[model samples]
Target: MTTSRTVPSVSVTYARNGGSTKSNELGMRVMQERAYEKRGEQYLLIKSPPASGKSRALMFIALDKLANQGLKQAIIVVPEKSIGSSFADEPLSKFGFWTDWTVTPKWNLCNAPGEEGGKVNAVETFLNSDDKVLVCTHATFRFAVDKFGVEAFDNRLIAVDEFHHVSANPNNKLGQHLGEFIARDKVHVVAMTGSYFRGDAEAVLAPHDESRFDTVTYTYYEQLNGYEYLKTLDIGYFFYSGSYADDILSVLDADEKTIVHIPNVNSRESTKDKHREVEHIIDALGEWQGTDPTTGFQLVKTPEGRILKIADLVDDEASKRDKVSAALKDPAQKNNRDHVDIIVALGMAKEGFDWIWCEHALTVGYRASLTEIIQIIGRATRDAKGKTRARFTNLIAEPDASEEAVTEAVNDTLKAIAASLLMEQVLAPRFNFTPKTPQSGPVDGFDYGEGGYDPEKSNVGFNEESGQFQIEIKGLAEPKSKEADRICREDLNEVIAAFVQDKQALERGLFDGEHAGGETLPEELTQVRMGKIVKDKFPELDDEDQEAVRQHAVAALNLTQKAKEIAVTGPDVEKGNTALIDGVRRYAMDVRELDIDLIDRINPFGEAYAILAKTMSEESLKQVAAIISGKRVNLTPDEARELARRAVRFKQERGRLPSVTSPDPWEKRMAEGIAFLARMKAEAENA
Candidate 1:
């Protein structure tokens, strides 16, 4: 399978320190602004993308906490030695910060040579001192906590970088120590990470612990969109049947600044010959000249007779590593793309290794983890002076002979493609919702006064105001005058909520489960079953209101089916463009070019609104309209029943009455539910 798609980049403006401040790194400024806003809080978790200025954001906040706040000291913990450089000495005050960020030479434990005991000793040395800030690797901190105990960290703020390294599993040493610290309540923590989601599906933190954190999430879309220079990033996969080493240059340009990652040695496709792979790429480029003595970059003459310099990061020789490292790090080589035409890496250069001039990240073979894919892509995302766009291409080998292997390969590829699709949404600018004025004719899917929302009318619209797509929900009918009102009036959420919350009902309604009357339902949610479920869920609603919701519900389900067919199956069945490998057809599509207009035409709120709109009814719509208009609605018996059910469930689970003042949406819902129930109960007692 081979395909390509443009990664959409959106631009943004952000305020720093509550004042409008412009900087070269828009991602940094945005994070700084958010951190500055939450500086008063004890624990701050910044979830951001790679190269999104998370490290610098931590520096800004930690410095403030140590100097201005009553925090005694700060410690920056990193996962690896390579990543420790991110926290190296920086002149923050020069960049408009209040103070400079420094890690004393002796206290910086990254390059410190020692066993666990030596690391422990160095940690104790730093802890006993009155130093404002200290930097160390994760292993050093783990040993220090075990050797000296958690008591040593009291009154200190622990800023953990690459926060995802700590897992919820009790056996994860770092996580265990973190749990102890949280339990003590003496230490303040700032968790930072480019990738927060665990690839292994393990919880990053326990639920109760995660709740206490004041999280500031900055997405990839915000970072890339706000870039001063970087505009587009194209990610795609190229499939081949032969050895990747022989076919790599077909997709990778030798003239471009590129990093070529050789397959893992343990994998079946691995040649176990990094030198051989390098030789192949070198031969494909042209004749290799002897290495340059002044800068260890190997010079190669291309077929066009162009001289290209290549850095071999996979070489095991110490002397070669030193010379190459020096050449790559030399100030003269910075932003000089011609000097480093290609970097051949086996395992290094995935994270925290900065090469601002890199324009192409070409990897040989599949990366099973999505987190790694994002990290590898980060290598080429840095804002370079002249570079406007970057590209990531994966050259994967097609699966051979075995049927099981073929199935696995196809499934993994499909999953990767799906992930890329979702990532595009994550990195794209969010749509802003607004109330649509009642139209004389049909507008974007909605017809005012008729309570009609057609899925076919939905679409993705680019707005000049926000420089992003706007999801236009047309129509102003029934009561409330807001986009959410249209969603509620249709009961889109209600139908979805009912089926989702009840597995048996969902199976019966959508997946052919046995009914009470012994009638067998269809394997999929048909229009007939949808109507019945919608009616059953809203017994209190009148026929007219119920009918409108039912129609919307059916429309939503139909639209979902249509989308699945068009997006997933249509291309394969219609175009016959899929490749047959080991008897399994591998479908390739450029997900980045997905028709957002087509996706937009379908209302996400249709089914959900259909569910919620049922019970909402005419009178309930008035109550909702009143709420939207900032007017209060006195509780009635039916309203009371809905509120009571949710409230009782909340109290039963938590062993206490849910707070009416809680800012949590679920808690507020439960409180309202219970309030209505209480009112109805009171009326019943009087009767």
Candidate 2:
């Protein structure tokens, strides 16, 4: 029986995994209702298991929130365009006053010359409507400055779908984009997803700027806490961390009626690494190898030098959408009989993938996240009749292989599961590809049309005539865009916050309201001050330095000079800001200044070489100096003198000169060094 949770039904049908919505299957009613209602309580997280239906639940909540005065219009930034756009029409259309449009431009516009991207169309449409709801791909929403220009995608109510996608390591462009966008109070957003694989926490938290979320809720798929919604399905899984396919073959050799799934390999080791390990597992199966033990089909018999092949083991290259859609339907795969027994896999076939055929799974990757560990477990929770929960086994290479590390891995996996579950409170309907029909009545009002718009000012409105206050978004780029302004919003607000705290000073004309009296805040000092104030104000804002009013002043300047220098290398803006600040901090208060360029007697290579090459490898320069003097290859004094005084060329030539033309790479380098050295000697002699 399904728990109370209610996830949305795709064109596909879903038997409740385990967790059910507490009441009415909308908005995580039982758990998060109180938190949502109160102010300063917008950060509670909810956990939902795989197939627990979090997407649909969150969709309903988002729709319900649309009715609020705070959320008349909103933007959902779809990480994967295919998944988010699939449900854009119906559930969103339900709000009678809000219009929803998917902003992923349908491909294939060869015939139309004037079309831009889906972003352009969505904005134009939103401008035309009275109540606008925009759903766009991360590309369109995240890269607005480059794609549609800055003015196109600004929205007060915004939701970044599948936030976990932006959580992996490395400097991220999307995370930076979303972080800056979501930091505003006007934008009421919910980051939706079912995967929260952990990376460096500091980097991950830096992007969401968690302080901005009204509520942060978390739930775990394991232990089935707030996400008891997923427990109804018999959760079965196999664990085999650090175990080879060969090891698992040994264990599964005795079983029949099993379906094994594997993913395609990409690395250089792909062809041999895992395959070689399978051979070892086959040998370990001993007497059970290839005897069917059930139908007597001898499916896993090991030949002298061969590995065992389990029945129904296939590799599908398509994404979870196709693999899942197909697995959900066809029972017979690749000449295999209906009802697969054991599923084996790697890579894409691992966690986050849904496969009903899998009754038994081996955690062979040695080390995997807890979310991965549990996702593999949650895979078997389908409640199909006569479908028994598969047994789970973890493959371990050694009896005591760093239990502490394994424990941490499992804990992290569990934490990720909790994160995904909580995220599901908002994922269910949004991931809905196809909506089901109401048995009796017409649901026409379900497709709510946005009522009106003012494209120029991003003026939002819906049911204003009925006393409902709505916000509108302007259609085209303006001379001065809101986003450019919003980028500095936090800094401005913090300074304003400090100003509010000291309102008495403000009324006293703190050096004339418009202008500051103290010499304009030093470029470096402003940043130092701003970062300090902001850190003091919210303490939770991730990327922003929290000094009260200094950050505001720095933001006023188009990024400090230090900030510009750091940008040239392209890293997180805050890192650059910090670097700039640090650099400024290092400058001595009572400083010793030195001129970088001091004219000494020009180097032996003459002033010409000095000017021609400001910087080069020591060896390369030696070659240049040698070439001028002919020191390495004997030359007459007249020859050296002529080469030197005959109007030596002066313009600076960046980088190393042709080191040498020798056939050998190393030889060329050596020869060039000697030649430059000789030239330098000649220039010195002439000097």
Candidate 3:
């Protein structure tokens, strides 16, 4: 049997306050109520976690638009037919709302039996008719918009669900069409998404277009913290060797209600024969009894003599798969915890697939898209009675030095690390940073540790009710422009997503320390690398604005890492929901003062490397380090220019240029950058 080792990258505990699930007088949950308050805005974006009632939120807003806002109609656009069911009719009046959300059966194109191209006539018919709401897939809407110009859909509220599917890339038809509609300025638009950033590093909307929309953000910390159940959520990955089927039992607990996503046929980890793999997994469990006729679930008796009802969605046979799919989606059984034990799927049960009792989400290989990973994790995050813990596990193949695919395996490993880092930021509490001036004081709602806020040093204050951290860092660059401030408040995660995904930055940060040639200074990645990424991501911003964003993003990432290190290593490992909060306070108290320079000196990936050492085999770890170290890269001209810019800032503040002989590593690195850039200019002049 192949050995299986799993390490949880992030295990967050929540408060279980039950505030999110509780509804207001209008029967709107916390997030939904917040979104409803902004219904008057013509352009709005709802960024909330899954199972946070985004569908109901849209219903509340869409109904208001129809009855009160004087809008002609509401078009709900979803990425797939499965997600289209989210916009189904709701009896809002029964829940204290003034009106109901109804989409006429004929106008619900998702349930209709025709191709998207053939649905254009229905869209035209609905526009000409008095139907208040229409629901369809993104494909159907794209085709309809192509057939009918932007002018044809005027005076309507177009609500896009899974908004991340629409990209700012010119090639993205839906995104292009949405831009056209915004330019026309004739219709109202509302976009909702569980994850705002895409895994492929593309913007969902252009800067100017995104700025037009008033954003309503409900972070994962807030959503999970306010839950009635699911107190802890663990995100982890396992590395396995040889066929995954042989090692499946190591991580796949038969007691937990899990959804195992087998690898795609094209993925390197796949054995190429999916059917055989499924049979192997079943056999590994125990004796297989006959299939249940009604649910079409395969009955397998585990070693403990308990029968397991597993839904096999990997089968290509349409009749068999459809029966299993129908049974899984049966609304009557949604609340029944024992309805299904495990689900083995290939491409289904990811987006919009709801299984509230799922204790774990397990996948065989690394998913290329971070958005996909987030959605898969969401499947297990639903709050169910007695289910206090939910976890997501990724089973990846370990790299082998003898294999030709070693390089490919290394890339997958890096991508998996990137995904873990991004998820950590997403799951952490929201950070509100401010410069530490002489007049700095504690915010109104925040709790400033045991001794209260200090006047002489930086303070870390946490507001449990708001699920936010008010941190005062000395020398933190404050954003001047409104747009820059908005980004620092709302889009720091998006900025971090780009930074962690950078190939060079991730490579160096992960494996280029003492094991490799030279030690990578924290400022090299935090200042020069992140600075370049921010400038490229938002070219519209001025130099000062760009620096402000860079500082904020770096501080957020590094502080979280520092906090996690303290929490995990501290005596009280199970500190419950307040672990992170306590960790931050402890870190602040341990240091003399919290400053931007001290924060930048921290390697954001240090905690990650420590965890990696504990989980991966020493030999395999060395192999990965060797593979990455083989491709040692010199500083590029772009990096040199970015560092030189930093050197200039250093000179302005310290009254002298950074010295190569300086004891400080950051100062020496800046001096080296200046030398590198000067040498390049000299060589260019000679050429």
Candidate 4:
């Protein structure tokens, strides 16, 4: 009894919780609480998901600094005019905050009609006066800065929302202005953004500058998984053979609250006629009741004579623009918020536009950017009164082999699929892990050779009571090497999977590209000789990329070996489990949904190894550094206990165990012994 729409969709699954509404009443939300904790820091970057209350968090911190911390002024800058409303004044006391957030109407220069000079003059007036908060668009801020210069706003707090608009490129005006502000060192900055990681896939700030700020990341998982009403969000793709407008009726629900985005004007798939498409959809719905003047809703009569209300944001008339925008925001004349059935928009409602009742966000075209897709998806994720679930459906055209643009269309579709998979990874819960057991010596029957460490030999398990996912690894210094090994192995696996999946991989001749016909190597020699072949094949790749290919080949060989070895262990032994050996440690994966396919699907940011290398957490960096420094060891219980006894004896004899002032060999050894003893005791107690 399932329909065509249900059959063609791919299910997107992720971890979620029952939901939380503590923030709905105001005061400080979970994320805002995190911000308030870091209020004392000079530079703060709040990386949070959209609709997670970053604006209110900034208000709380800015007010605290302006009223109590002696900051001269606070300037709030947004990327667009509609976003400026997010900073509108709020009665804080009613919401349990100490003071109200006040923005004078005169200083709020968003969407004010005039040229660059007029906006600059307005900024000048605000700066000259005693206004504590001035809100303006990023364009206006740029013009004002050009006219008044950076020194005019010295000692003030500049809080930039949607901080991803800034990038390393010199052509990006806001980015350049932020760099200058950082260089001057006169202003304190609080940069906030929902799309900080993937916008343009470019550095938002220079490495040295980005390092100066203390960052607080509120992941998409934390926000959605903690919601009170909404439980699940499904992101799926539906492909059609013809025009999206013609195929629209197959996937869209007329009864559901939905926003339908037509194809971009420049897209090859676009008919270049949005109005006709709108008309076609309206005709399919029912009879036309004409536009309602009172509420600005376009009323239509269905074949059943049922009237359907639509908000036509694509209307080009300048006069209707304001009315349409207002109606889109509220959509209710007498508190009937859900009166509008469908909102057909061109480009108006993508970012920073809040409509709480939307249940479906439908887009008809390929958008290459993952950041843009995430923003579009966020529109339907807002928790509402009766909304229990949400969906994001992408309607893309399937490639036609007979068509002239088939090659390009096929490539674009593959890229979109890759981006969708990557988004799932980003939105899903991350795995965080620490060593659960101390490393023991090498186990019997286990081999590190090409035929040794197979999938069958690998041991992985989940402890329901403790909520831990455990994996067994070889060698003692396992704790120190766990993170590095996991990262290297996973990254290498991804590269190999991409190599196998991509048609371009063979066309590029990644393997045997430069090799001429010669004597065939033996089957066993193929694995042994693949690295040199890969390195020689892609000579155009830089040293790093070349090295990655070689690493991928090696990793594939090792994985095959593991799988074979695990097979030899027999079916009686559980998968992913091996007998405990000396120098082996048990590690726990803190992430959920660890899948090989998911790992391979992250398509953006060219090399997986490079991205992981650049974005490792401080603790992970320390672990990697320690492993690289060759300082990790597998200590036995006897050794750990003896070290502890010796440390105690030393302290009693000398009144102090060691001194960090000097790099003396004996002091360093004593310190290491004492630390190892403490670690062993802690491990034993936890066990």
Candidate 5:
């Protein structure tokens, strides 16, 4: 196999303080304790990373709600039956809690052997009975709500796990049911998810409905930093020319425990023969021995004499695949490092499939949504004893100039980049931005680095324990309403998700630069495009609130990119744990000032493009740019209006309208916007 030429787009090293794994008096970890503290809230949303004790967190809160809060019953809804295993009987009392969590065998409809339609009856029976908890899939819950109506499940707790499955779209039954439940307002609802945003860019909840829930957010930085092991997590993508299996071994290290998710049959990367592909992967590994009789795991001896126990979940044979699946999920071998080495799957092992020993999650194609990508990354992030580092690699097919589906290939490339960008934001430390003012000072717990809270300029402060950055940016807009403030504080990443996923913004940002003759200006994306996205997304927010959200979202995204660029290229790159924090401070110092305009002036995807250039072949990169540039259209009336607004703001601040001859690219672009509008007006009047 040829050696792979791929660099990690985002490599984050943690302090490994062991704080997250430590249990409190009630046997709750840090995140669980945090979630349990808000157990009394009628509407609670838990936004925590995978394996940060989200399962136990729900148990702790559900128990409290039942015993102390007068809730009659708890219905735990999960995305799939496999995840239902997470809510299985937990002996909390053995771990020093007041009570143990137990679900009646029959009431646990997920384990019931039947279609979801049949399980709705079990849900109805359980609701009528005195059982404290009933665990079922989201489907069963939806069907039950449909048959019995929302009022039948009153005075109970509805805990939706993997809550990102619900969407605010009217077509999404779960979201519609949730809205009805909230409108009824008799039941307490607790929603939990590692990714709150949908891959399809649908809102998880309506604004008015979302505002009612008290949010408990636990950052990925805090979870990974406090781990006892697993000091580093690397996320990257690789571009391959031919079939993916031939290039699989280039990035797949046999010794590390890994999950290889082959491309779907319809995906461009797939060779269309999954079984043969699996056989090919097995053959490439080494001489394959017979399947293990007891476990059904295919045993192979590498040339180095190491035996690799591989689980093949892609097989179409149900009995054989079931045995392999059962072997992987066997509780007796959960912590045994040698239980399984590699899991090759097509549609399994993604959401809630746990194998703590996984050191690499290699996916063959771009997943359908960012939520899936986050879930796949979570597979490799679980802290294990010997797993000091874990990485997630997306092996994608490079766009070929000879292919008829080159446009589709380019779209996949853009989507992959978008996923990478969002994951960086998700994994990095949270940012708390305030407008730089004379009254600004360092917060109580934050350390302002060497200079220690310089009031004369915008400063960057970091609170290591909380894994949050305190930033002051000049001319930053602050949200006026409580809902808007909550969004700015807690939902900036969600905003960034929508922004990066915007096709127009992403297309222009990635390909419209020097390769496409440099006609696209940064302000068009940062201001007009992003401005339109924010307005359409949160129509409830007024102009100032929208601008505030826009500024905060853009600043957070751009600063993270800037910090990553500094951290990776800095002189002290070896100190990866502190590189990001130091990079943020160093950037602020280098620029001499931090402001919204300066942040917006920088292309959010510039560094991404630089990384893309390094990874993809020069020829393939040019093909993608050519395909995107060919589709570029002239400015729309809406775009002109947005830029004209920015021009108005520019004139107010600089005492003159932007001139076409201005040396500044942004000023010249604003002038072009004015000219476009004027030309349109003249033509309309003449017509």
Candidate 6:
């Protein structure tokens, strides 16, 4: 039967990073938007799924509140150093006057000489400085007061991120200090949590005494205010818990979630024969099964499963490292996307990681602490679509674990995040958590390109505050047209082509932005010469991205190249290696002689030049899958690869080939089936 070809759409709606409706006017969503809408409340406590855009939501609301007529300043607190700039780098920042107001350990109102009076100085500066300030922490709120004295920060609004840390260890000196400082006021507070917040909020918030503000929380199953952030990962749930794999397939027949039920394998050759079975399984799945939409990567189903320990999985140091490397060859096993769905080891999925459209989570490892568990679960707990959307986080508890215990663990850990945001609601709205004190000497830290990224290569810290977007995005791409026409039109397609061209230009630059889950980062090429502005705004015909440049240079070659392999001929044909070499040579010649008339004709195997590229290598798949009820394109990468192999066999056959399930037999069966159906239809139609 003849099959349909892929129909290309002339226009497409590009996904927006900051979710907006008008396609241009950026606004708040889910939890943060809900919190902002309820501005009259003295305390705004939000329990949102992490990476569900809680940080962005809270930052936007804080900025909005701080910008209101009567507000003075705000404060924010967080655990990670990377989180400090989530608000600082936003283009829609409404806090122009407050840029210098927030106070943090690395950044504060006054400078500390030789680190002397570092904490006390930070507090004193915030208290004494006329500009309203946000007080944040690497150190606890208590430490800030101890260094500067309690009088310095009396009624300031406070925000705590990863809020449970405050109560995680209350007996510490700094904990007591913050506990005491916050006791003086119960106004303007926000504590944010991605996990469900439980436990004694009073002991954590007003540790010095029993003080509690009214609490407010939004979870994934309930609302949409923050749900938009999680739309990509909605299908993430199926594979993680290893539940409903078959159900998912049956329900969404045309659109199925290819579950590479990949178990871990050993990749090391030095390993004993004991673990070979699993090693074979994993090695088989690691090869290029398909190429993705990006066109460069051969998309493979990444094996992501927890391997049981033995004299193998976790035996010796050398073996362990080898085993780890082998197992992680699968993208899903790396706790990364590209693979459909997975439930993996926590050791792999750390912070600052996200997967596009993947927001379901299943935590199985019992050894991890509550904090690590929260981070793991929240990795996929993005905000949802529809009403204040939030992911439906599921905890597959081991029989030994108690519901109360798990809830308590979640509460105790996430409270710090909840506390910091609540503190911001009461004290500083926009980045009120203590802001970073500016570095005095030659500032030295990791340099993240514009927008708070720790640039892959770093020996120096950087601030885009004083730079232009053109300069700030030194290595990142920019839109050539600054085009904002209809979302779907021929003009949009034209601009998208320009968008791809602009992307190629950025790829040639020293700093290059590589796609990650929710964000992008520049790969550092070198530091000898820092890139200034694109001196030539529309730089001259840049050939640095020569491969990306379309040209007629390759038109006159007289050879053609196609994908080659070690063809396993019948037992009679002993010239395997020679035949492979000849096939490759002749294929190259075939590609060289290809007609130059058509520009859009993609050599079915790939570009003729791709045969020699490092990334184009292929072998039998690591995991081979076949589509059941639909087309091959309807199948996954692995399925399509199998179909391609079948088609390749058909192409190579010049004589008799094996006829296990011959076309005539299948056709006869179809004819008989049709005859029976036709008789029934004739009777029914006649009746």
**What is candidate 2's TM-score against the reference?**
0.41
List TM-scores for all candidates, in order: 0.65, 0.41, 0.99, 0.67, 0.98, 0.36
lDDT of 5 by residue, 1-687 (tens): 433387789999999999989999889998999998899899999999888889899999999999999999999999998898899899999988999999888888878998877798888888888879999999889999999999999999999999999999999999999999999999999999998468999899999999999999999999999999899999999988888888889888998999999999999999999999999999989999889999999999999998899999999999999999999999999989999999999999989988999999999999978999999999999999978999999999988888999888988999999999999999899999999988888899999999798989899999988999999999999999998899998999889999999999999998896534557878788899999999999999999999999999999999999999998899869997889999999999999689999999888988999999899888888878877788888789899889899999999999999999999988987898899999999999999
Taking the tens digit of each residue's C-alpha lDDT, what string does model 4 give over 275-393? 88888778777788888896577898877667888888887886786787786666244235556888888787888978877889988888766567778888888877677778888
Sort by TM-score, best first. Answer: 3, 5, 4, 1, 2, 6
TM-score of 1: 0.65
**How far off is residue 360 in model 6, in Å?**
5.3
Position 338, candidate 3: lDDT: 90
The residue pairs found clashing in candidate 3 are: none
Ranking by lDDT: 5, 3, 4, 1, 2, 6
Write one digit per residue (lDDT tens) for candidate 3, span 649-679. 9989989999999998789888988999999
Error of 2 at 620 (Å): 55
Runs of candidate 5 with Cα error greater than 4 angstroms are 1-4, 514-517
Selected candidate, larger TM-score, 2 vs 3: 3
Candidate 1, residues 1-687: lDDT per residue as tens digits? 122222221111221122112353322376567776787678788877777677888888887788888888898999887677788888877766667889887777887777768878877877778888888888889989988899889988999988878887988999999888888888899998776344454556664565567778665655665666676666656555557777776787876789888888865456887788788888888899989887777789988988888888778897997789778777676767666778888778887778988988888767765567667888887777677777887765554434345534433433344334333334443333332333322334321222344234432333222223333334311323232233333225335434333323332332122221222223123323343455575544554445445444433333333332343334443222110110011110222222222222333323322322232233433333232233223344544454454466457768987788897634664576577666667899999
- Whichever of 1 and 4 has more TM-score, that candidate is 4
TM-score of 4: 0.67
> lDDT of each model, Cα atoms only?
0.59, 0.35, 0.91, 0.60, 0.91, 0.32
Cα lDDT tens digits, model 6, 45-147, are: 5655555556665555565556662444566666654345443434442532232223343443122234434554565566666655453453645556566
lDDT of 1 at 100: 80
Q: How many backbone collisions does model 1 have?
A: 28
Better structure of 2 and 5 per TM-score: 5
Model 2, residue 630: what's the lDDT? 32
